[model samples]
Target: MSMLNEWQDYLPDFLDGLVVTLQLTGVSLLLGLPLGLGLALAMTARRPAIRWPATLLVEVGRGAPALVVLYFVYYGLPQLSLTWSSFACAAIALAFTTSAYTADIFRAGISSIPVGHREACQALGLSHAKELRLVVLPQAIRVVIPPLVGFCILLYQGTSLAFAVSVPELLSRAYSQASITYQFTATLTLAGLVYGAISLAAVALMRARWPRRTPTITAGATRPPEPPTRTHPSWETTSERRER
Candidate 1:
């Protein structure tokens, strides 16, 4: 009844693969995050000079299939003089490619912010950058967090594609086990369970920790109660009282 026995026996080997999968996912996200944000900002730029090229890059990146991107990075890159290790190249390529996607995530988050927030900041005499860092970005980043975690889960799953390029991550590990044991179905089932568990864990953890608050609470627009008596001693009130 307990699956702990399998883990107890091969815990170290599984851990090694788990560590590689986590690294592949983490490095991609770390590299992609800033790049995505910068790209999102650039795409949203008012200047056509900035917007056009950035827009092009975002569009092209989004348009291309991730697996194709991986293939090009792995198989195509070395056709030139440049050479890269399998793990390094896969990480770099996935990072840069997914950065484009993450940029869109952030861009949407940033744009979802209201004009009034910026105006309010302006009224307070905060500069554009300060407003972004202080008022706008905080909210946008919050709005983006759930989805970004969702994307991280996605990136975690996508690490399986690293097998295409020969990175010994979960998928590659499973493939190795399959070749030796000829239990491809069982091995792949285990891989699927690992990926599912990771994604569900991400979702569950984010929900438990954050559990998105209602927009009204964060917006601070709740009205105060009216005074019980407008003014007991007011002339109008006194006149009405005298009449009564």
Candidate 2:
């Protein structure tokens, strides 16, 4: 009975925090995914000048811990005369992390294309840009949908780290409530259950949306199997007669 009352009292605040959480996540993905795609392309560029710097950025973003990155954006950037609100800092930090991590995912999807497809495009007189635009990317995106969805789930959970920067996300709300009511266990348990529920639902949706078969390298280009060879009885009899 008391637990029910506690939930009713705190649920509204947590929901407000959840709204913030979703906003932060949406903003980060909107900013991050395109940057991630660009980084993936840059990392795979033909020139070292383009590729090396992109590689370094990807490495640093992936190598650093998420909390450390958040702290760097929220606190450290102010030292360089660059300042932002806690919400902005959190969004920027998470977006940076998202771009770095998702770059590799995008790169793997792009690279999974069989070399033959690119050569075929070249033979058809398509420019590299056209080949990528018309052929490679469409297929790569289809191959990558499942992993991208999985990454989004991770990024959603990772928004909790923004609380350290005082972004008023879900974890921060739970902490604030716990501190005030001295009900750390109950408040935090509810917060965790909420997170779990959303994450599981996202995973279920991804599984349902994920393609059942491997996407073909190119549309309408599946190769048919070769016909089996068979010897006719007449041919076998002729051969036997010649042998006799």
Candidate 3:
């Protein structure tokens, strides 16, 4: 009966917590996506100037613990005589960590574009920026979107770490509300459910954006298909015999 009463007190506090969680998640995506894509381009760069620095950043962030990064930003920044609020530090560190992983995803997507297409672009006399901006990246984006959205969902789950830095995000707020209302179990259980729902929704969104692999048929379906190249050798042989 007492626990049931405690559940009643949670509605308002949990809603407030959820708002902060969404805000942090939004800020992370806004900061991380473009930066991640740019870093991905950097990884593909042939120049040591760009490649080495991007490589170093991506490797270190991906290698390090997110929580440690959080702590470093939250606690270590103050030591250098630069002040940042805990929420700002948490958002920035989380965004940085997310960008590191996203860069690799972007790099893979961009590089997987067929070599022949790049040569085609060069043969057509397209400039580097023009080729990428108009042709290469647009194709790569279709391949990248699903995984990036999945990564963003992973990112959304990660926002819970913001609580460690004193951000009043869902998990942290649950802690406060539970502590005060003595409904720790109920409060946290609901919070867990909320996280699960958000993840499920994000996954569904990813699935909805799936790329179509094959081109749609036109009236050309009634036309004869081209003969295979293996059979074309006989035609070449016939041509040579006629010449002789």
Which is the leading candidate under lDDT? Answer: 2
Tell me how far the alpha carbon of residue 243 in candidate 1 is from the true structure, in angstroms, after superposition.
67
Where does model 2 exceed 4 Å of error?
A: 211-244
lDDT of 2 by residue, 29-98 (tens): 9999999999989987889999999989988888787789989988899999999999999999989988
Scored by lDDT, model 1 comes in at 0.73
Instruction: Provide backbone clash counts, one per model.
Output: 0, 0, 0
TM-score of 1: 0.82
lDDT of candidates 1 onward, in order = 0.73, 0.82, 0.75
Off by over 4 Å in 1: 1-11, 217-244
For model 3 the local lDDT of residue 222 reads: 36
Q: Provide the TM-score for each candidate, comma-separated.
A: 0.82, 0.87, 0.83
Arrange candidates, best TM-score first: 2, 3, 1
Model number with the top TM-score: 2
**Could you give candidate 1's per-residue lDDT for residues 1-244 as a string of tens digits?**
2345443434455567778999999899889889988998887777999999887987767666677777888888889866788888888877876777777778877777776777789999998789888987887786677667766776787787788888888888878877876766666777778777887887789889887665432344343211112111111234433432
